[model samples]
Target chain A: MSDKDTTYQVPIGPIHPALKEPFMINFRLDGETIVDAEAHPGMNHRGIEFMGMHRNPLKVIPLSERICGICSIVHQHMFTTAVEHAAGIEPTNRARYIRTIMAELERIHSHVLWAGVAAHEIGFDTHLHFTWKVREKVMDLLEYIAGNRVNYSMWTIGGVRRDITEKMYPKVNETLDYYESLYKKLEEIFLGDPSIRLRTKDIGILTEEEALRLCGVGPTVRASGVKKDVRIDQPYAAYGDLDLDYVIPSRYGYENTGDVFSKTLVRLKELVQSIDLIRQCVDQMPEGDIDSEPKKAVLLNKLKKADGEGIGRIEAPRGEAFHYARLKEGQEELDCWKIRASTYNNLTTYAPMFMGEQIADIPIIAACIDPCIGCMDRAEIVEINSGERYSYTHEELHVLSVEKTKKILEGSL
Target chain B: MNTIDLPMSLDELESYFKEGLGDSISDLRKEEIKKGLNNRPVKLIWFTVSRGSFRKSIELISDIQIPHLSVTSGSDLGDVVELIYHFAVNYGYPGDEVSVNIKVHLPKDDLTIPTITDLVPGAITTEREKQEFLGIKVENIPDSRRLWLDEGFPEDRYPWRWDETGMENMSRYVHDKEEAANPPTEDTPREGGGKDE
Candidate 1:
């Protein structure tokens, strides 16, 4: 690794075999070691937040779900909660419980998806296949319960648009049992296997201090030994009533190795917790009206005065998602609405993590944050060589990334 | 937690801005604010004013020191370009949700306002996106980088621009498509579209 040796620059991209979405990372490599790294985002800017203002308030529900497909329910929940706050309506206890069940279901599906992705990233093809196979059950259950697998538009302004009937309870219970059993098997595979440990342990180590400074959220922050779960800090929905512990890695079986393994363990354990929470919601379900009766249609026809400002904070699967809205006196739509995804705050740490790490470790290290790649797809990267600066298109980078990743996987296998 | 009660009704909140803040607020009505549909509270207040007063209004309202700037949303309203700056203050506490709305209207001709990045640092990235998308000039903002703007996109082109018909005509062309398709050979021209052969 001497200075005279020819150094190579490796670009992992907006689309690669390892990632489902778009994001680009450039690694300045000295041999196998990554000496420097830079992350460029903005590749998938849909301008959905801007669209929120122009569209009708009711129409925004479907639009909000499009914010992030994997975490669609959370997006809908956040938007609906903000609308509820704006409208000054408090949902009933049963409605809160139903919302919590949906939220937990989403968390389970999201974590399982990440686990599968993590497996694929590390060249664990069998594990990847197995995890996704089990994940299909959860997705199927989601579709059965919410009428759709990805974006469950169940949440409405005042309460859930639909109710979980008694007939649905048995199916819910069966699904929970199946997921829990599958989780046990997956847990053994992820934690008990030596290869899994070797690939992840001590690699992509994000220390507690780095986690705090970088404002990392979700499992990434939890794995680093920070006990800042939004469920505990600001409990919305039925989470306020549940006697559940925020499953941090430090509390459980694993010592804080500050590595990808720790993050994996935290996410896996949270999957179990999500299942248990859903079970509790279903068992103690109260019989009540699911939807609020619509007020007089005449009241809705009038031009509602927009007044006051409010902030809506929800813990999306990635981490804390925030929305701010202000209403003007006579405008039909919101005067102001601002959204900050957890990834926006957490992505800043990519540079530090990538630096001083091996190029092979980049995928897992980067994916450890579970970044919202779609959010950052709009950015373009230009490389400066000698005096000339050449721009790299996202498509070019994506193709190169997939080729390199496939090569790496074949070599590792 | 106990239910929080605020001193002002939705109309009072609107009046506070109209008389106290001296700005025009829109979308405020007693019926909208009072209606509790599905047990969810509906709070409403609207304000509209000249676009020139946006920065000042933001500065004045944000003086209360709300820790979080939740989001900033911009929309095209045919004749006038509307920008909304949402601020959250002490809403969690009982009797404290007196949220303020300061609306600023920018005529089609002049669509620029002073950037509030100095006051709220978190607004840096979102403000840049809005500026480029809506063709709004945010003066005094720290970072001027073209966030979503890249090669093949015109400097003045806006992605979210809606004309009187509310259609976005901004096109994102592929400037490097040719270069990508026919990569530079050893003898191609390097400076321009192709490397010297």
Candidate 2:
């Protein structure tokens, strides 16, 4: 067969084989190696922006929170911040601190969940079970604070709907302590485990230049030693008063390799940093009304009469995400609304990371970004010359990944 | 409030664009919102550049620092499509980041903006999204295929637009539009009460 005939197209999802988020990555493979990769997202686009533009500003809060199940707080924070910015309304100082704590708590939960998913992707079920079991403490805290584990509608336009009152401080501290206690063990399993090191080290490497050119966000880019965290770079809410630094891989004597290992390193370290940040917020949280304009009628009237543009940017657990909100005078609805999630920017970096990697590495590399992508489904492989097709279910993909791990353990890979 | 350890301040950026783009730049404004106990300022610079000077303004910004393009937000504003390029500069320097939002008004008749993928490779996603949603052609985009909308979604009907070519015909707003056409005078009450009616 000619060299051209050897190329095969492997489409691994707009039907995700990983999590429930639907995203498709089409791979042009030469033999078992991925020659090129492209991301096809939007299978799950509910047109949230369209819905947001149609509704009044206040009604859009719940809609924004539903944007991503994993990062609901991220969306709600951006939406409220954007609306508040446009309307020129300052959230109470206490509200800012509460927002910071909630955001940091969400970050911890998200990163811990991501750790479990990453472990599962590499066929480490025990690690997955352990990480997930450990993640419950934060989830419980979140539920206690916001009354909902997933879509915590704690945010309002001017301020927040909920407060991190003294009643909830003990639960928050206990959760933080639980994670802090488990941090070292979690670190050892994901970072120190030799098998995981084999699968992740120098695998799916994205250089700093590629990261910068592609505008990759979150730990995905920070792994490459990029200082682009929104929290540190542009302080919003209580981040301005708080002290924090970038969580790049090099900070702990590791090279900024921009590999899957570096990415893991960044996330695991951030878990500790998140714990520190939440504690700072709890200690320094001020005394004031959680809601700036508690009267809904007054807030709604102000919003309807406000005419301006605002942008809300946040450093989500995954990366830097922002929302654009425009309010017009005498308009009951938003003049314009745009929500840019972190995965949207990180999607571009997939091309560079997937290039020249083996098919077995797809799951780990794909999950490395902690993608808030589309739902999981089966993958189909097409052979060009034969015009033949084969399908791989999620179970089959998991098997392939597990088998790869076995091979690596046996030193056959 | 936007204290920076870097050489470039928010004011310097304002002057830099003025010097580089000259008359093409208009509606220049610098805003800093203070927050938190420290009262730290979140700095932002908003300005408009003629479509002819759009790429030039970005290049001038690039001369000082490698500007990070944080997606573009586009809207269908009556006779023109407004595209705002939100770029963040001085990221490595902590607490010094400035959101330089550059606006360009593309007339509805000629809805085209040159692709900045060459300058900002990551902009391809947002640019492609703008093309499919607003029906504004991104001039010379490397990959111009639709990003968000389905293949079966009508090509002529832009969802963001509220005009004849927009999706208003099939939208719920279509019914509301007819009702809105009639005036609500002193005899009739508005949709929401004037003072809790």
What candidate 1 gets wrong by more than 4 Å, as runs, is A1-8, A293-303, A374-413, B1-144, B150-197
Give DockQ per model, in order.
0.09, 0.64
Q: List model 1's recovered fraction of native interface contacts, to 2 decimals.
A: 0.10
In the range B51-149, model 1's lDDT, one tens digit per residue, is 555565565555443323445566566776767654434333322333344456677788778887666655666677778768888787787776665
Of the candidates shown, which would achieve the greatest DockQ relative to the real structure?
Answer: 2
Candidate 1 residue-wise lDDT, A348-396, digit = tens: 5566666677655666777777876732222233333443334444344
The local lDDT score (0 to 100) that residue B30 gets in candidate 1 is: 36
Off by over 4 Å in 2: B1-7, B172-197
Using alpha carbons, what is the TM-score of model 2?
A: 0.94
On TM-score, the leading prediction is: 2
| Whole-model lDDT values for every prediction | 0.64, 0.88
lDDT of 1: 0.64
Residues A337-391 of candidate 2 have per-residue lDDT tens digits of 9999998999999999999898888888998888987434777899999989998
